[model samples]
Target: MASRLAQLEGPIDTVYADIYNESGLRKETTLSKELGFKGKLIVHPAQIKIVNEVFTPSKSEVEQARKIIDAAHKAEKQGKGVVNLDGKMIDLPVIKQAEAILEYYNRLVINNQ
Candidate 1:
């Protein structure tokens, strides 16, 4: 099931696992997050905290995304189409992804507060 989910393109969201067991749910939620799931479906109220913690982007992830956007902007200002960041090439797709991550992070912050 996870392998099949991995093959799908675009933003994948809402994975489900056993809801009765908090430990098992946490593990599955973490695994789902690692596999690129944007969120999870919760059948129990107790599951919410674990799923939210697993899916929220870390501070380092947000920082790295900011750096990616900054690098892309710098490249554009220099009349270059792409830039190398941390030895990896940053292009349109990567820039868009960084933008999406920051956008998602912002939305989460706004909604949570």
Candidate 2:
């Protein structure tokens, strides 16, 4: 199953309702996240909530992302845009990742309302 999953995973980042029902969608979302799928697809836009829930970073992740962007911004103000976070490099890319997640969540909230 792992081999087959890895094979299909890359090409099928977007899931299908035909392949999965509402309950299956929920399961697939969890499986996809475990398999490294960033998001899922839905025949109707209504499935966005499930996908959003599956893909949305956890509270801790959101906080870390926010911190990364904040620190990046501070570095930029100092004429820098890179540093080391827990021995890992923090740069514009990291900031962009954070911004992308925040934007995604914000969009979901706005559109789902």
Most accurate candidate by lDDT: 1
lDDT minimum window of 10 residues, candidate 2: 3-12
- Give stretches of model 1 more than 4 Å off: 1-17
Whole-model lDDT, candidate 1? 0.80
Instruction: Tell me the tens digit of each residue's lDDT in model 1 across 65-107.
Output: 9999999989999999999999999999899879988988888
Q: Please give, for residues 1-113, the per-residue lDDT of candidate 2 as tens digits.
A: 55456655333466565543667788878898787566676777767777777787777777888888878877778898687776789977688778977886666555668
**Cα RMSD for predicted model 2:** 6.6
Relative to the true structure, candidate 2 reaches a TM of 0.59
What do the candidate models score in CA lDDT, each in turn?
0.80, 0.73
When summed lDDT is taken over every stretch of 10 residues in candidate 1, the lowest stretch is 8-17
RMSD of each: 4.1, 6.6
